[model samples]
Target chain A: MPTQPTDQGPLTSQFAGDADMLELLDMFVSELGARSEQMRDLLASRRMDDLRTVAHQLKGAAGGYGYPMLSQAAGVLESQLAAPVRDLGEVAHAVAELQSICDRAIRGHRPAA
Target chain B: MSQGTSTHVRIDAANLESTRPLVLAIDDSPDVVRLLQVRLKSEAVEFASASSGLEGIELARRLRPAVILLDIEMPGTDGFEILRMLKESPDTVQTPVIMLSGLSSAHDKVTAFDLGAADYVTKPFDIAELRVRVRAAIRTFTLFQMLAQRAQIDGLTGLWNRSHFDRRLVEEVSRHARHASPLALAMLDVDRFKHVNDSFGHPAGDAVLAGVGSLLRKIVRDSDVPCRYGGEEFALLMPDTTPEDAAAVCERVRQMLEQVTWPRHPEHNVTISIGIAGAAKATQLAPEAWVERADRNLYAAKSGGRNRVVWTSIESPLQLNRAG
Candidate 1:
């Protein structure tokens, strides 16, 4: 656990306390690095649609996985991508911020049980 | 209500389906389905998943899962369209559907409910909350199942009642007519049932009837429908069974009953006479006429000898075989 709750913590799943969910949470954490890489690839290729799809999925999935901040970050990115007026700078900033959280989650993670 | 209701959900599990209810989750994301399977594992339910709308709907029809978890957005036909099709099909209409969506707007919720969804849960779900909702939906679905089925059952023997037999006879006849498939109808009567009642009292007579019901229930094929035709008489409608096959089954019932020794009157043996009428293609006569044919055969069985089976198939004249 870290001092800050949402943005600066050990990124432990809220479900870590649930004995039945430990394995599912562990599998999700193990897959985090690949998900991050997929995001990077989609962004690098300028496949905004595919990247937005990924963001939408994460927006739904992250909170369920007990990372509410990651869910919120991906949700913001998804909303920004949906906007008709393109804000390239804001979109890039959101992507970068989401990537950093993913980094923190991958680095600080310890599997429950 | 006259005890024609079947409280069979908790029956000895031999004569009815008692397996855990199935929960089907339809979502494009494998992770969401995987998460659901892990979260909802329990004694009361089993879990299955489909990745697309079409697969989900097809599975829904085939498995008749107790509950369906539908995702609103996907690559192919969306959840709303799938829900519409499910509602349209009678096979899946009664199953409880819970919509899973990323969109939580009141408009979306209202639309799902309008389309006959029992509940809606927005993603990122509180897993615990989803579990509770799923259980509630299963409760509703199974209750509906029991209420719909119990109406057709006979309370005394746990077999279908007379009215149900009549209705299903017509339905089966029409269905067989359409398909040009074989169907068999058998009329059975307890031989000297009145003698048992006169000597052993009404309770023993009732016990004999109950024992015959269990024997019929145990011996018949799954596709067969055995019913109490009223007092000392029973009927069985066998879909897709030929006259020869039907006679074989009837002979077994006759022989079995002839061998049963009443517990109170150990020396007394109960017997039944059965007459079966069948056709590969449905006979052109009304179902009542068909019943009369079987009744005539039952008369032959009783006159020829008690504890015997008589049968006739369409494309052949009235036939009689004396068998134990």
Candidate 2:
């Protein structure tokens, strides 16, 4: 098993047995994974407009799936991308953080006892 | 993994029933559409989706859905534009619309409401709240449908009222003129109906009228519009029928009425006199004039005998004028 991120702990006890919540978490992980890769490519190409759009979408989608911290990370990237003079390095850091969140989200809430 | 997770767009032809109320979701994102499909599936409604604003408007015009869930930030024609277009078209003017958007700004909500949206729901909505809103919209739509239907029908007889009949006559006349199709009109009145009310009570009179209304409803062809024109008077507009054919139909109805054993007054039977007019091809006469001709023939039927049909063809305008 992959080492889990310190910030994203194991699956919450409340969500462990609920099938619908688990499905939603799974969907969020998958969707975030796609957006993270897209953001990385857009940053490499210095496509600030496209990167901002992806960030804006992720900001809304993450919050909807109960990942408020991930949503805020995406929102920060979105705000920076909309700046008149964008910092590629900062945007890259945000994208990497987003990818980490998605990785942790997919790893489930907790390691099996 | 992401490719595998893409939503399956299931346009299930079998799920679409003509009688079922439709709920349309118009969003560019397939995820949102899929979410709506999943959420709305359990409701007593059918769900349809469009990925673009133009397609959404076209579907709205065609399907006339009970409620529209429109996304505000679509690519080309945004939600406000689509809402304006929906209000402009007569076909969809009355359809209720609910705006959906990720933008939760008060300005956006106010603008949506100002543009005549029935409700506004932000993205990441509470599924339960949306279900309640959708159910409420359906109720409103159903109530409007029932009220409109009730307005067009007579309460006592359960037949189309005089106002609806007149409107239908105008519409039929315009359609027949455009297509040059044959059309026929018939008018009937109960013989000495006042005597029935005088001898029996008004409730008995109403029963007789209702009985005749039921008979008219049962006897007319699907293409025929049977209406209770006024007190004890009924009219039928038969499309694609000639004067001779309308006369036969009227004759059949007259016979049916004659055979009925009056529930209130079985000893004395009720009878009707009928008059028919037909445009074998097309006519330049106004709708009122056509009805006047039928009315004139009805007078003839009453004068000749209270239990027969009188008819005039549009080809014999001179004879019609003389008879009138």
Return the top candidate by TM-score.
Answer: 2
The alpha-carbon deviation from the true structure for residue B33 of candidate 1, after best TM-score superposition, in angstroms, is: 1.4
Chain B in candidate 2 has what TM-score?
0.86
RMSD values, in order shown? 8.7, 5.6
- TM-score each candidate: 0.78, 0.79
Specify the CAPRI tier of model 1.
Answer: acceptable
DockQ score, prediction 1: 0.33
The superposed Cα distance between candidate 1 and the true structure at residue A3, in angstroms, equals 21
Q: Write the per-residue lDDT of candidate 2 for residues A1-113, one digit (tens) a residue.
A: 23345565533323345444555555555565566677778788887776776776666555555666676788788777778987777778778877777666766553232
Report candidate 1's interface RMSD in Å. 12.3
Chain A of candidate 1 gets a TM-score of: 0.85
Candidate 1 structure lDDT: 0.84
lDDT measured at residue B161 in model 2 versus the true structure, 0 to 100: 96
